[model samples]
Target: MVNEPSNSANGGARRPWITTVAILLVVLLAVGAYLKLRPRRIRISVVQPALQAVSSSITTNGKIEPIHSFEAHAPLAVTVKKVLIKEGDRVKAGQLLLVLDDSRARSDLALARTRLKTAQAGYSALLAGGSQQQLLVRQADRQKAITDRDAAQRQLSSLERLQQRGAASPDEVAAARDRFSRAQADLAQLDSQVRYSPQDLARSKAEIADAEANIAVAQETIRNSNIRAPFDGTVYYLPARLGAFVNAGELLLQEADLSQMQVRAFVDEPELGRLAVGETTKITWDALPGRTWQGTVTTVPSTVVNRGSRVVGEVLCKFDNSDRLLLPNLNVSVTIIANSKDNALTVPREAVREDAGHSFLYVLQGNRLHRREIKLGISNLTRVEILSGISQNDIIAVHSFSPAPFSDGVEVKIVENPS
Candidate 1:
């Protein structure tokens, strides 16, 4: 029965195949159009603002120092005679720390004493009218002058009597009177030499004073050669060695009361305004790992200065060091608590954006980002305090996963909801 197939039968069979093919093409076209025209949702990271405790702080390098410290220096050019204590030794007030060679000072003192003695002798002589020898000479001269005057007076009287009686010539009487007058003048000159004028007394007194001042200075120099602690402290630096020569004003030793300490912190110039007195500070030393010290800002920088490659301000901080674990001039790290708040509405700092000097945040509303201006309070390394324009329950976009920029009214899909 190999007979020709009917055209209507074959046509009916092909029609079903053609219809299925056309339906498949229509489905693909519809899918392509939908993909090209539909709104794109960007994958992003989102976070919810929450109430948290936040603190703003500044950290910088610092140096440990003593609050009340003492330093001893060589008072004059001398050799160190004795070292009574070693470095790091605890000392009491008035404790002798070192002694310098005071032979020169002693010699100077002896010379000054001799000068003072001589000056005093001269001054006493002036007060007593004159020196012992000068007084003796003046007394002898006065006695002789008195005798001569009396003799001349007796002779003048005799001459007058003789003249009246015509026993002596007029020329002899005149000569006796002249002798009496000359003797009287000589006696008067000797008396004036014994008395001292006011100007002479003052000059003598000044010499005595000058000699006494020299003696005092020499004595002080001798005393200073024996170095002593001014207060109870630890000797942290001892540059003077036994038998070592040092110049005047050379550093000998340094000591401090370790019960309290200070830190000279160098803060960047831009961070100076945030520093205030009484602010809490935390300190740590590299030499002592894991150890921490507490302090407060005592002094703020008045001016900025160059520190290495940066401009910085020196801040003073005071703290207690009852244990005395820290040493002077040791480099340390400091943290100043600029501001802190508790139970503040805060969000991730990355969530906030800046535009035209104003802060804004991308708030997620119904799966779409909306730019809303925000008032910020304080900020920390990781979080920022939201003063207004947002609630703790509000969801905000932190960052986007795609390269496309965020805009207002843009749809987003949260890829990461970081806690």
Candidate 2:
């Protein structure tokens, strides 16, 4: 048989202090009522998808370069005698930019002229009759030959008559005829060699032509010594100064027409395949803030190359820089408008997340969140396009960087806006 305690003993064992126990029980009941009457709290906001304009652009770095440029060089060894055009001076085509020491060229030209004069005189003498002294000697020889022939003829006639009269021998008569024949032969020789021949004329003319070519070359060299602008442009580089000695083919100056410019933008090799001509480009220079220049894609990249530390493809952009604000080799920022659209359904970029090559969004369904994958289209910096898996009125969650992010299916209060 089990022994049982009395009622008074049981009561005493159960309660350390009945009055204190009653007080604690009442406090707990009060706390339970207060908790049931209060509302849950959350720090988040919900917004429906918006139908707005969306576009995308490719931003990159580029440099400005002149379209037309000319570099002048010395044609022969020369000293810089004068510098007429300074750096940054605008000049017209054919304007004299500088002058090299032309003394050597001038002296060479004088010598060429003297040679030309000599050649011309020789050519003229060949074309005209023989020279004065030569003509005088030929004429005197012809007259002497004529007189000797006449005397020989008279002697021959006398000898013939003497032979006929039987007072002279046949041998004497034959000697007189031979003398006459010799005189006649001498006169004929003088006549045949009298004046200019065709061969002489041709040789003298060829020498004249050679001398004229030399004179023309010397004049051209002298003209080249005076450096002149090849086109209307601004002188940007001047390496030659007064009294500076420069050798042939050495750089003297550089000038360019800054009205038309090219913006060379280097793009990553991976992104080069998407580039195409006729794309619009916007340019900005750090040196001149708040100013923008516009251009169009003139050429697509043909090959990839290593530029600095990156393997990139270089693109050419053409711009009408008539204002002369853009300069050569100036680093600038470029933004290309690859594609754009108006009145497209879009969402804030922050609400989109990427997972396994697909984008997702957390939707505010009821008091909890739902995870849904979405299809995207053209996206700009601030907005993203939602093509499917969502509607215009669907509420999406937005996560902030400084706060503790929310998880899917978490209970949340509908705070239309929480700042």
Candidate 3:
């Protein structure tokens, strides 16, 4: 009777309710503990100022170029009969690089020589006193003509006097007048012969000189058919072979003076001011790794090249680390040291961010990130030169954790071992 009374006194209904309430409380507490204690995995990189060394430099893309590269082309139209060199063959100045058929050139030269010889003979004859036989014939003809004209003049004068005095018949006077007119024409023609003699000689000489000039030009064309190297260089590419036809100024071979060479590199505008002539540079070619060649800035182009980036200019660096192993047109990487200052305040590149053209750093203060605007100078790829807004001893945040539980006024318990 007592047990039955106890079951009815506090029924199973109340027991179930109490048990459910306790279970709910335990679940809530466990959830709160999990949220507080669970670690947050984050990706981060550390920040540190890089120390300067002898090899400390700023790297940029570069290319290997020849210092004395030149293209050999045919000087005149000709057919290639033979090529003496192949690509990668060493050549010397004035060495025969190739030979053209030159049959046409030879024919041209022969024709020109024949014309020149004829001109020379004529010129020689002109230089030699006039031919004796021709001179004698002209002189004799002139003298005889003059004699006949004088006789005719005398007869005409007589005829005129007779006509005036009426002592001669009309028919006789007319005959004498006709003879005088014919003689006068002959005398005038004779005088013209003497006047033109020197002019004829001068005309002949000019013709001879013109023919001689043509001959000289033809000879030059023939000589040009035998292609020769203009400078001591290596044959980088030879496009012509025996029996290949070539035209005037057509590319035959490409040669480069390997003894002296340079690397042509484009510098971005942001880094141009840092480059200077005589500044040493380190170069690494993609073809050759683990081997760095030394070079110096020899020249800087004055004009800005319009590439994707507003290229400040092109730089020509003289490579002193040339070996037979190095060839032309090889891609290279160049490193230049803009400047360095000992004990300078610097920070990780990620620590800085741009906002409206102003740079700022996220600094950690009492487990909270603080935004501090900074003045920037030069920067390499990894570190930025800090002009102001930061001290050497200040620890700056390389990354950020924002819009989470922490705010401007929120209290943050920085995980001692932040994952």
Q: Pick by TM-score: which candidate is best? A: 1
The candidates, ranked best first by TM-score, are 1, 2, 3
Query: Relative to the true structure, how large is the alpha-carbon lDDT of every model?
Result: 0.92, 0.85, 0.73
Deviation in angstroms for 127 in model 3?
A: 12
Measured by lDDT, the strongest candidate is 1
What's the CA RMSD for each of the models? Answer: 5.0, 8.6, 7.0
Give the per-residue lDDT digits (tens) of candidate 1, residues 1-419.
Answer: 33446776788889999999999999999999999778889888888888888999999999988999998888899999999999999999999999999999899989989998998888888888788887898788899999999999999999899999899999999999999999999999987773789989898888889888988988998899999999999999998999999999999999999989999999999899999999999999887889899989999999999999989999999999999998898899999999999999999888899999999999999989999999999998899999999987888999898767889999998886534
- Better by TM-score, candidate 3 or 1: 1
CA error at residue 398 for candidate 2, angstroms: 2.2
In the range 57-174, model 2's lDDT, one tens digit per residue, is: 7888999888899988887899998999788999999999888888888888898889889888877765556676766887899999999989999999999999999999999999
Residue 181 CA error for candidate 3 (Å)?
Answer: 10
TM-score of 1: 0.80
Estimated TM-score per prediction? Answer: 0.80, 0.64, 0.63
Check candidate 3 and list the clashing pairs. none
How many clashes show up per model? 0, 0, 0
Off by over 4 Å in 2: 1-43, 106-220, 365-368, 400-411, 416-419
Q: How does candidate 2 fare on TM-score? A: 0.64
